[model samples]
Target: MKLKTTLFLLFSILGFSQQNNPASTDSIKKTNIFKLGEVIVTNHQNQETTNRVTSKTMESQNKMEVSRALNLLPGINLTASGSRNESMVTIRGFDLRQVPVYMDGIPVYVPYDGYVDLARFTTFDLAAITVSKGFSSIIYGPNSLGGAINLVSRKPTKKFEFDGSLGLIDTDGQRSNLNIGTNLGKFYVQGGLSYLDRKYYQMSKDFVPMKNEDGKERDNLYRTDQKVSIKIGWTPNKNSEYALGYINQKGEKGNPVYAGSDTQNSLLARPRYWQWPNWDKESIYFISNTHLNDKNNFKTRLYYDKFKNLLISYDDANYTSITKPYAFQSFYDDYTYGANLEYESRFIPKNTLKFAVQFKEDVHRENNAGEPVRRFDDQTITIGLEDIYKVTAKFTVIPGVSYNSRENKQAQDYNSTTKAISDYPNAGKSEALNAQIGLFYQFTELQKLGASVSQKTRFATIKDRYSYRMGTAIPNPDLKPETALNYELNYNVQFFGKLNFQTAIFYSSLTNVILSISNVEPGKSQMQNFGEAEYKGIEAQLSYTPIQKLIITANYTYLERKNITNPAVHFTDVPNTKVIGTVEYAPLEALKLIANTEFNSSRYSTSYGISVPDYTLLNGFVSTKVLKYVSIDAGINNISDRNYSLVEGYPEEGRNFFVTVRFFNSN
Candidate 1:
């Protein structure tokens, strides 16, 4: 399959590359600091870019996972479950529980819902993404105390067009996608659909089914997921525009990859087993994303996301005795509405000032047949002002201040049967005032230096305020918000040569940290306001393209995290060191072949002791343009099929292959 893809791509390139085309805006800004598609980006430039591995869009694929892709950045760690989406992201040694995420400058974070399922998001229509490490994210509120990820969706192009991709996987896996766009007078419409499916994989030579608690053997289950979206935009004139979009997704949940089975201490180890659920989600969004007179920015959006999950499991005692099965049926509804306004202008000849205001509300409700009904409501408002004073042609100073207020409410209702869990306002009405100051200096034509200091806050999430479960999961309503004092230094130097390198270092002190700690008994845990935690790290990135068709890149990160309370317990799940390297060869304009590898060091599972071993994996892919409007590609993951475990008891997929095909209609 890979060979076929390679041949197809070669032919496509031969036919397509021969015809020269106009260069894109991204290509022109390849080396510019504010270029549109440059991977190394400084959204607002917290520091120097030449030394920072700041941004990336196609690290592995055109679509990259926030956790997996961001981990390549210096001081960033992604704690995930076999790349299946339920993972958490941590930066600069801070816990995933503290980091926040944004979309197009809007705070898309849920006040109390710490889980930002990255699996549900796609980068199909994104212009660029910015990842602010350490104190760099102070400009954004709330979760920015730990750092932040900003996903910027692309706007409609001036001309109508279409683009898409297709592929297949080895051993009964296949995928395909299609996208189309058109502009009729003042109205624009776009629609897209994608389908993906993978069969169960065998991890080892003795790949026998695992026995369940009841001693019944269980088979590995893969997935078949589908996504569809349609969007429409209307522009009365240059002054206003509105967009409406709907996204729907449905798929099988993934079972935790497992390591081994303990026949004697089966009970303790069994709790670590994983099972995929039967679930689905659908959402609708409306946005008035328009610029006022091209100088002022304004946006208003509303969205609702609905999900249904069917969880199946058996009791521990069901091993020796036969018992009826239990199923947890749950439905989740999320509604969000928000607006933002911003203005940028130069009040003084060489001085620039920017002011912005934002408001957002989120409501989530979860209902289960036998469990208590859960409701979460949260709202936030923020006002900010910043001034950039150009001290001289070679230097600038930026000073900014922001005031934000947040309110969250959680309620659990009961009607007999099971007792209602505690309902507490863990995060009351809280408000914070943060301030930041940054200085940028151009040392020479080839060197730039930047430094910044800031104060930031992270509010308690809904899960911390009102979460309850048995064995290893307990909610603490008394958990307090997290705060941080951060410092950063960036250095970027460019020499008159073919080689380019970037480096950045950051440090932060976090107080009132929020974390999940295991209790005395197994399968029991609680979330609380732990004491201070310190995280510091540095990142280095190097890239060189000998020619337009060949590119090589390498990245490395080193991070350290410690709990101020004990100082001995190393933060869990975060790896101390990570490295990635990639090589791409584009022999023909339409043909691209890439080889990539990732390395992760040993990591802890719990603060007390249990840890996972370090491992490295190699993967490769070849993509080809089969025709003017179609393309094909194939790749292999876990090439060696190493039997390794990321999370306890959960084993990862062994060697696997996938193929995809794409179709586009521009006319």
Candidate 2:
């Protein structure tokens, strides 16, 4: 459907729904979300600059993956790495390496590249996902140059609870998940398991044939993922609590070949036959919160995370044969261990003070076919202090500062010509200081205005400073950290009991950006801190419950990014404009209908000027309660069957259908 037609239909439905009978309210209680992982800031008027996506929202939209779920929020855009077949999201034009990801307050990004494939993170076990924008809390530790995303797990508050779902996608795809938990006053336990698999996906009928692809089912479009999670908690008293958690995820996927017309002599556009035989991660963590006295509280978190993956490249589309020069196998084994300690005190009246210290160590080991393993190690430390002071009944001030340092303990250099390995020279060390302040004014009970400015820094990842890029790049261990100064103004207001609106204007100035400079040596590039950039954006969100039976929500974002040092170099993958709208209507208590639409403006696919065309998508779903304890949902995504690509050559799935049945019982 056309964008204009879709919007008209949405509003037409809203107009027709006004005459319908009121729908009954749902009785399901709010799921218990873990609070220990949250960054505590001033609670004045609850104006902290954080957005959240609850489990209910994920279920309503059928967003089974973290990346897709996050896209529902303003200022966040979903993107794909076609060559790697990995899903990612950018926040206000910043990539995942700068935004970072966390599970229960522990960093989960890959230690080497500082990125995690969000598609591999299933949403079945999460209670909520929280995103903090530019003005993030300093207590989150280092590397939050853009923002932070935290996945909050569920905690059992009832004696017995169970939730499970089984789903079928297209014809061959399948998905299933189960979550069970129990609480016994002082002790509680929760566990979850989820699996998703798909053999192939069909392309839109309008998709034109290319050298590497034709109409119908796309080649090598298969994926499988499985995850298991468990947590145990003990509450000794009202003032003390402890928890231990474990999570494991396993996945495998194939990369479809390039299907665009830019294939003449351009290596970047060449088709690739790539597959990931193994993509796995595991994490174990312990967290504790204790109240020292009426004036103070302390918290601690300790975690160990491991990641392993294997990539195989073939010369052609054939399933076998790796004898060609472009064919090879790569493997990575990485791990990280970290600890955080925080103390909060309210000894001074009308003031809250927080102190936090964090330590982390990362190790990366990798090798190619017939090559010896190369290893790298690094250590990081951060100390932060923040205070929330109430200046008056309607005014609040929050100020924070953090000191961060990183040291490269060991790095191995491999010489392809000699087949020899040696220690890398000039082991790098770096330090940075970050500070931020926010001012908030509560003009009235239903209106608030806030402003904030922050200075953040991100250290170069191990790969950034030392990767040879398969002989195409030189290792520059002396690369400095990248920094960004951010400014934002936000307003929140409620016009009526059913209407709410929020808006923000944000700007960021980036300096010493890490960019790959060509021809540092003959035919080789080097990563250096040599670029400057600016990102400015405006975001607005609105929600209205016209009546008890109908609700409508919409969000829009406009972003502009400029390369100050090189005007010719364009920012890739992030759309200049994005809009999303959703409508939920319940004509009956047991039955509901939902429709959603999304639009994205054209975006650069490569720094060399290639662009992906703009597109709009429409989706619809029907949900109904069957038995007293069961519910069923049927949905169709990309109702228009329009052919669209986030990246230049990678077309997304089209006109897909899904059916899900859920069972739940809580007491």
Candidate 3:
């Protein structure tokens, strides 16, 4: 449908339904978010640095992937690894390696590189996603240098419940998902399945033909993903619960050839063809909560996660020949197992104390075509303690500390020339002490102020310390852990029950930052921990309900990053400024209309000063109930067909439309 026609019809319906009562927002809040996995402080009190994205918001925005959904929030930026055709995100200037991802409180990042492709994670089976910025709970274990992200699954509150959706995209893409659950008085079971497939995407009309791109449909832009999740829980009593969960994901994608002009100077910047034949992950976990008494409680989590992938590099864009020097096949097999035990007690008056112990082991194996497999193993352990002290009726103070240690047990080096595998030298160990303190004051029933300071650390990943960077880098086995000291202040208030405002300012000082030092050897760079940096940002969010039928929300972020050790270097991926706003109108009890816009400032894409220009995008959607149990949503994204890129050469999709039908039933 044309944009003008769609807008006119929507407004006409709104005018005709003026006499009808406005629909209740509660209708979209049917999903039951799991509470056990939340890492919150001060029991039931909301923190200023924490934000949550609900299933309702995800559905309304048509955010099918985790990375896109997170982009809706302030202080989070969606980034694309164009060369690899992978979607990623950075939180407050911190990459995934510094801020780990978790599913139901269990670590899920890849063991080799400490990164996960957010595009492969679908939102169909999730109830909510929580993000903690700058100041996260120490009980979450180690590696929360910038913050943490947690994916919360759904729980069944009804005897029988089901939710499903099917969608079609203009770019020859299809998506479908199904979720079912049953909740008996003492037992419950939940299961979900989702699939997504896409052939290609069209570029903007304004895009000019490039070396490897023809200005039409993007080449090698195919993807397929399938996921399955299941959970079983038993609540023997009101004070105790245990659950077992499992998830499996399979994905495949083709990488688009580089289309930029900087390929001539750098050997690693050459245009190439690559395809991932298989990208698979599996996880199994068990969680339990038990109340020993009115003043004491215990919680435990045990999990095992596995990852496997195969990459094929072709000689040319045709993807048929592989006889060239760069043509090769690479494979990775990695796995991690972890366990956590937590104990909480309120035995002391006005004080809640918690203690935790965590242990994890990661093993990674990788090999190339006709090469011997090399292996690496690492083990980490953490011990933590925290206390929430109520200084007064309206004031609270939280203090936490943790000791983390990581030991490398084995690292095998492959000598291709001699065809011999030998142990790597200086297989070392590292340890760090993390600490944090937070203070919150309730000015009134509708106003709150908070301040926090934290010191966190992240150990170098196996790839960071061992990989040769395609024969252009040197392995540094003695690399030290990176550390950051973060500070934040925030305020939240509500006015007349119609407007909500939240604002926060954060600053982080980083030391021992891992950077690539050029000319460490004849023509190779080395990863060394000799750099320092600083990151500062401010975020604000506003939500207002002007009338019973209309709601408006907006958020803004301003960030700055500086390389203290070397001002000549630049930070990549994250923008300096971002603004997003949305407007929603409920014309009738069964119909709603939404319009949103996003603005991103220019950002550096390479350390040598390559940048992507800033751009703005508009999107619109309409949702209506067709039946008591079914609803339909139609939307158009990139309404202006603006040509934009998060990276230098990766032009984003142009104008496109999608239609989805969703069904929900509960009893």
Best by lDDT: 3
Give a tens-digit lDDT track for model 1, residues 346-382.
6477766667676767677776656655777778777
Q: lDDT score, residue 531, model 2?
A: 97
Per-model TM-score versus the true fold: 0.81, 0.94, 0.95
How accurate locally, in lDDT, is each candidate?
0.60, 0.87, 0.88
| lDDT (10s digit) by residue, model 3, range 1-667 | 3334533533333332223243332343554776676777755333332388888989988999999999999999999999889899999999999989999999999999898899999999998888888788887899999999999999877776667777788858888788888899899998998888889998899998887788788899999999999999999989899999999999999988776666633423567799998999999999999989999999999999999999999998899978999899999999999999999999999999999999999999999989989999999999999999999999999999999999999999988889999999856779999999999999998898899999999999998899998999999989899999999999899999999899899999999999999999999999999899999999999999989999999999999999999999999999999999999999898999999999999999998898999999999999999866668899999999999999988889999999987766655
User: Who wins the TM-score comparison?
Assistant: 3
- State residue 134's C-alpha deviation in candidate 3, in Å: 1.0
Model 3 CA deviation exceeding 4 Å by range: 1-31, 43-50, 263-269
Q: TM-score-based ranking, best first?
A: 3, 2, 1
Model 3 TM-score on a 0 to 1 scale: 0.95
Question: How far out, in Å, is residue 565 in model 2?
Answer: 0.6
- Each model's total of backbone clashes: 28, 0, 0
Who is ahead in TM-score, 1 or 2? 2
- How many steric overlaps does candidate 1 have? 28
Candidate 2: Cα lDDT at 324: 86
Q: What TM-score does structure 2 among the candidates reach?
A: 0.94
Error of 2 at 627 (Å): 0.9
